[model samples]
Target: MSVFIEKKKRLSNDSISQLEDELEDNPLDYNKWIKLIKQVMVKDKEEQIRNVFTKYLDIFKLDGEQWCKYINFEIGKGDFKKVEELFAKCITTVDNVELFRLYVSYVRRVNDVITGGEKARSTVISAFEFSVNRVGIDVKSGELWNDYSEFLKSWTPSQSWEKQQKIDLIRKLYKKLLVIPTEKVESMWSTYTKWENEVNSSTASRFIADKSAEFMEARAWNIEWNNITDKSLSRKVLPYGLDDSDKDNRKEIEQQLQYWYKWIEFESRNNLNLKDDDLLNKRIEYVYKQAIVSLPFVPELWYRYNQFLMNGPSTEDSNSLNMNIDILSQGLILNPKSYLLSFQLSELYEKETNLAKANEVINNLVNKLIQDHSQIIKQIEEINDKSIVKTQNINGDADNMDEDDVNKPKPGYFLSEHDIKSLKDLKLTEKELSRNITLVYTKLMMTNKRSSGIKESRQIFKQAKKFANIGFELYVENALMEYYSDNKKTANKVFELGLKTYGTNGKYLLAYLDYLIMVNEIESIKVLFEVSITNLLKEIEDPEGVDDMDTPVWIKNENLEKINNHKYFIKRLIKKYGKFATKFLDLGIVTSLEKRFKKYFPEDDELELFRSRYSYDSIDLIKYDLGKSVKYIEQDTRGDIDQFFDYDDETFDKNKRRKLDLPSKPKETAVANQPVIETQNGFIGESIYNLLRILPSASYYGNVEDHVFNSKKLVELFNSLDDIRNQ
Candidate 1:
């Protein structure tokens, strides 16, 4: 109960009316009474403070403390008129400068004064002048005459000081200082330096420079007016640290300074005229010497100087060329990996047809480019986090947030673990792709030159093509990881990312087919050709939309139209693979069908006729004993021989009787089924025709030995025949 009631304590007057009578006689007495009341309030004597103020208010009748307290009560009640009246009364009685300042501030804060605050302040100033003049102690007048004019100039007489007008006034004053006589500018510099050297004055001067209302403008004045010499400006600006904040602005300013500095130096060397040719040469030589001496490592400057020398008329240009080369040589000695200088030197050597040296330089450049690309790839790898699981807490201020949350950050993307790994692996794979592709492009380029090296270049191209294929495989994998499934933006980004990762790859064109799939944009035949097999399969669901219909086109127009181009593309691939397979066959056990046919068939007969008969579709033609046919043809000296007959089978006998109506030929009939034929002269015969007749026929029977032996012998004999024809 005591605690509850203690919170509701209100004013209880104990002291009496005598203090108010004294205050009425002297207004200073009221100030003293308020001061004592404040002291009681500070010491937690709140009850006493309230009692004295309340009792004095009743006694004075005019209520001086009550009048002051009314401002607070009025403000609390939002009563503007009562607040204004109490403020005016308080300000009139306020003798202390601090207290009067507080009263004016309060009046302004509430915006309830008699007039505008500025007009009220002016009235107070006039009244202050009158009262102080009468008393003969003018504080404001004395303050106005102080030695420091800076503070007075920047000082605000009204509350409107924060307005742009005041800021503009400060800016104008500083800019005006820039127009002062050059001597005054010099004097200011001397004064600044002197103050900066003194321990106590140094800090004060810096503080003034920083806190001055127009600091930036003043510094600009120093630069524009006082900075006549570079050395002087540099020294003056050292304390300012001109490159502190805005680097681009600083760079622009520095570029202008550098240009002017170079111009001045040029004028000094040439004596301000280009009329004298000898003097111009001297000036050029002087600048060249300076560049070589001052910037020994700047290849661009050296290159420029060399170009100028080459264009000049003097014989010394030749010497200059040599000197330029020598300088680069020296520079290269110091920095061997300077690609620009090396490239320049390589150009010089190549101009003289020194391709070996040029190639060496090119190789160096390629190595450096590769190294830089490798470093970038490594940096990208380092930044990509590859963790799988993460935990998170609900609260934002979760200090005990689970490690799993940190590990598995809320993804900006949707991708499975396999997808993430595939994407990461794809990035590294691109570097390999780029490097291999570059080598391939280089090899292909070398094939352009007509020289003895053409064969070697062709081999290089072959190797390049081999590696190009491998690179394409990796590139396709990367594109799939980028474009497939959730977070498919990876696919869209694959173009730019692949370029950065693998440079200008033909494979990127293939990768973009994934984008076409997601957006249903795969209408172009060209788009279909570039797509990988997997990408092509992805589009297989919509058979009527894609280019590669599984069935041929005349069967189904819409499906054929969709995949008309894809069928052609697949056919092309088959042709290519077929051609590729021949290489292995040519090098291995299988004789090319063309080689085998050429070996047995007569050169006089049309090859097409033989080809048709030997073709895979002509199974019945192939079923005939090729060896027997060859032997029979070799023995036929005349076109038609009745001796050529096979009467071994009833079918042959019947067909022959019907077609030829031949008489019984017993000897020929007996020779027909025999594996080896004997002549009437008792000649035992194993002829070339016999070998041809038996081998291929045996091969047709799935006799594995005939395939093994005949194919080898056919290629060997065909190769010999080609050699003889060439000779």
Candidate 2:
């Protein structure tokens, strides 16, 4: 080998040694031992391989994979005696069906290769017998039985008497397998029938009798399969093997149901020609009925039963419809509160156009709701009475007690007090219950076609209002009915009632506003908008007061909903009215509201943006005062005039000593003319300079007069002044 190959081999050997050391410390490391054995096998170390297999099997004897590796290794060595020995040992140590299978396969190979006559045949039969004894009772041991029967078929006898004996033995094994309740029992029966037909071709009478018996036995096997599955369903577990504690029991039951379903499907698939279609459907229906009878509380089984009935051959028959109805009705009796069963019943009635029955079912449900609501109200009243009594007792006791006794800290006082307060507050009032009951009653009456006229509907609304004076939904529903009936005036009245009762309700506010908008009532729309904005802001400001009448547990959630509703309404108004919405944005109130909202709800980005959109800067307009006179013009002009006076050059140098003061007229004339000319020029220059300065800085203001116009005018004035000064 090359030097590199030698190095690679040495490294693999080193790794094998390290792994072996690890296995010595932790012999249960099955994977490491497997890896080490693989490495040793690569080096072709026969003795090391044997030693590794021996050690691993001795440690992990119950592990099927280890036994398989050992058996496979022994078989590869072509040592029949060693393979047989390993099979015997594995069968005793491992309780795995695959190991038994491997053992049977090895025995068959040996019989084929060595042709050990009766001795090898006996070995194979013994292997089969051992496996049968070990795993024959397991429901999943169909493969083992299959392999055994196939092995017997593959084995041939040398003498006629021996052939008869072998045939009898195979028949006996088949009969024995027939008693085991497994999914593959039917296939086994088929196999047995085929074998008997080939074997007894000459004995016609005996073959017919035997086939008839086998057919009876097959029917018995089917019944036994049903019984086995039924028992498993009853136990809520699998029929064979150790129960898996980690698996869900419900899933196990579902799996058992699926098994039966599959068995029925198998019978249907295979016996299509042999069995009558009606008989097959009846058999499947019988099994489904048995299942529902056993697990009537399971809605899934009921649904499956309904599906079977609907899709069955008799689906269009009257009896099938009645049967489906009876099944669902029975299911409802088992679980009266099951909405699925109730809905199914309603659908069945509607399908048949049994309007009376459908109405009756709906009436029953409505009555149930009313009774439930009444019971709840009574319970709430009892709790409130108890709370009131407790409060009275506490107050009376406090009055009789000393100051210290009354003020002393008590354990659980806060918790008990809170519980009492919650019990008192968390109740649907009589008005609320009456409101719901009225709506349900109206629905029941209308559903039966007993009340169809507008007058009847109006009477129903009036009765509902009498019961619940301030029910918001009742008001809205009444208004909607009137509006839909073209009773516009009544609808407006109902809407106003709803607004008066539930001013903070965004739905009512929006509905009334929409109606106003539809009527072209702009003033009413404005009023509604203002009222909604005020109520929403008020609710947000004092959420505690707003939610006091609601459930205490939902107070925070109600507050959040109110904030969201506020945001929603504000956005709607802005989207609909645009500039008209600016009238609602009060700076002082909104700023304070924003501060409070931030303190309580800092994460409300929508509300934050709403606040920022209407802040002072967002609305304030900037004005530039370019028309104002300049302040420093007089001072600049005086400095320019003084510069003109301070001038005098060579002529002044000669006249400086002539009189030390020139003639008064010339001096006065010079002074007079200089002031006039310089002052005029200075004023024009200052005006142009100031206008240029103002033009650049004018953009700081929000509404500077048109820049283009100002620029043109200033340029024109400056050019005219320049022309005048040049002349």
Candidate 3:
């Protein structure tokens, strides 16, 4: 491998080497893998080709098309055994109808039904059965269902009893297919009814009667599916990456996620109007399964699905817990490093009272993360490529360089496939992975705490601290545990230790301050609050001062933290140190802090009470107005070059010098309203339509330009808007 890489370094434009180099940097790039595979195929080196395909499929286990590609590659080379092997592996790992279809296709090709024995026919039958058993629940799998039914119909027997059995089997299959709540169900119903009538009128009538309810349900499914399922949504679940700045792509991804949520809700809410709880549960589980197939790397879905199965109407105790374990375990396989999935899987085991298994699950995650963390971090540093040098092409000019810097490739010029998997299933960056590692450590600590006790948890926390690469949550969690265990001294010590490590981080400082407040460490709280605020402010690179700087989200968050810290301190110390509160939470600072955040709160009850308590300002209405309008008022203060909007109260259009006379009338009783809008209760909706009919319209007395703006309709619209605002 070293020699191969060394050889590649001398070949600047070698496609194979370049592709391999790119793949080494980002193994998850599917396009790169395809390019590499195509290049490899040119050489016809079967082993190397197989190796590449193996790695590709291993990463994208859910991609049935890729599996088909591999199988096709083998089949093209007349390697039937390899094709069969590939099909077996794909069928076991992937729940994809296309993959199953491909396998069925292969089975038919290999075993010629015309000349082959009963074994060949049996193989074909089994293939169809297996395909349906696995992926027949997919609503979009209309093609697969049609193919299976048609395939089964093709088989006919001559013996009287055998023919009857075949008819019975086909009837059973059709009946099952008809009720599956797929779009195909409509066509399936038509076919089933036709086939039944063809066989016998009496049998068809009875069969149709028995299936009327299911047929109705399937019809409802069709309607809901049509409404909810966006055909534009690509169900292809590839492990990919995303660029955060790509807002359009992000919106598309969010829309896809919402579509899945709708599908899940539709199933779980008895949207099909199913009478049976068991049927609803089955359908809900089916939707979750389909979602997982499309988003296997999404840990949250797995967690939610597991929770659904582990509790509520869907749960079945041991069965539910085991099911949760299986689902979560599968999620962990796809999202190998997902802390959330790992934690939940362990939680399931713990719930089962399998302490050893629970410990094993968390321990396994921590161990794997530990093994890969350093390497992943190292790869990131390499990807950063600090040694990059700007140069002129071929000319070797130092100062005179290519002008196409905008198109110049960076270290990560290619979109990361892992990110596209979220392209939230996308690969986590070094910082993100580090956070997950910390989370995993916390989970491990918790697992041990639950199973072993505080002593073990403390030791685990000590080890976590030694790692020193984690965030403050490790310390906070441990300290709180100690505090809750009636060891305030130990907890305080833990906090003090973390203070040295994370004093500058606003989050840690706030957490530490909260601890101080909870314990009523008055003097310590004062010192820590001052120290924390100072450290946090200094931590932000605000040498020019924060007052004039453009506050980005991160900066706003820091300032928000500062305000929260102040609020915590003031709320605790307000009565005894009202003057101190006034000094820190002074009007200007409070206004600036609040300007960055607005929860759209209904009212300021606390602020009103505080104002009532203190005679700080007599002009309460003016204060309130300023507070509400601060966002607009602070756009820019009076400066020589600053722009401001000046307005006059007597503003009017010269064209509308004459005010138009408009008729006004009181609202009439329901009897006088339009019959369309009238009811026993009262007139429904706006009633403007009927009111306009009754009020009458006056013509063209104003300037044509002012006509639309000054009309009664405009007045009504303004009134409606005012009503909304008042509400």
Predicted structure with the largest TM-score when compared to the true one: 3
Worst ten-residue run, lDDT, model 3? 652-661
Model 1 regions lying over 4 Å from their true place = 1-271, 274-278, 292-298, 314-321, 331-339, 380-727
Q: Which is the winner by TM-score between candidate 1 and candidate 3?
A: 3
| Model 3 local distance difference test score | 0.65
Q: Which residue pairs of candidate 2 clash?
A: none
Q: TM-score for every candidate vs. truth?
A: 0.26, 0.39, 0.62
What is the lDDT of every predicted structure here? 0.42, 0.60, 0.65
Estimate the lDDT of model 2: 0.60
Candidate 2, TM-score vs. the true structure? 0.39
lDDT string for model 3 (340-370, tens) is 7877878777777787888778777876776
Model 1: ten consecutive residues of lowest lDDT: 233-242
Positional deviation of residue 220's Cα in model 1 after best superposition, in angstroms: 27
- Candidate 2, 136-225: lDDT as tens digits: 644556899998887777766688998888888888887677755555777776777777778876763464465555456555655656
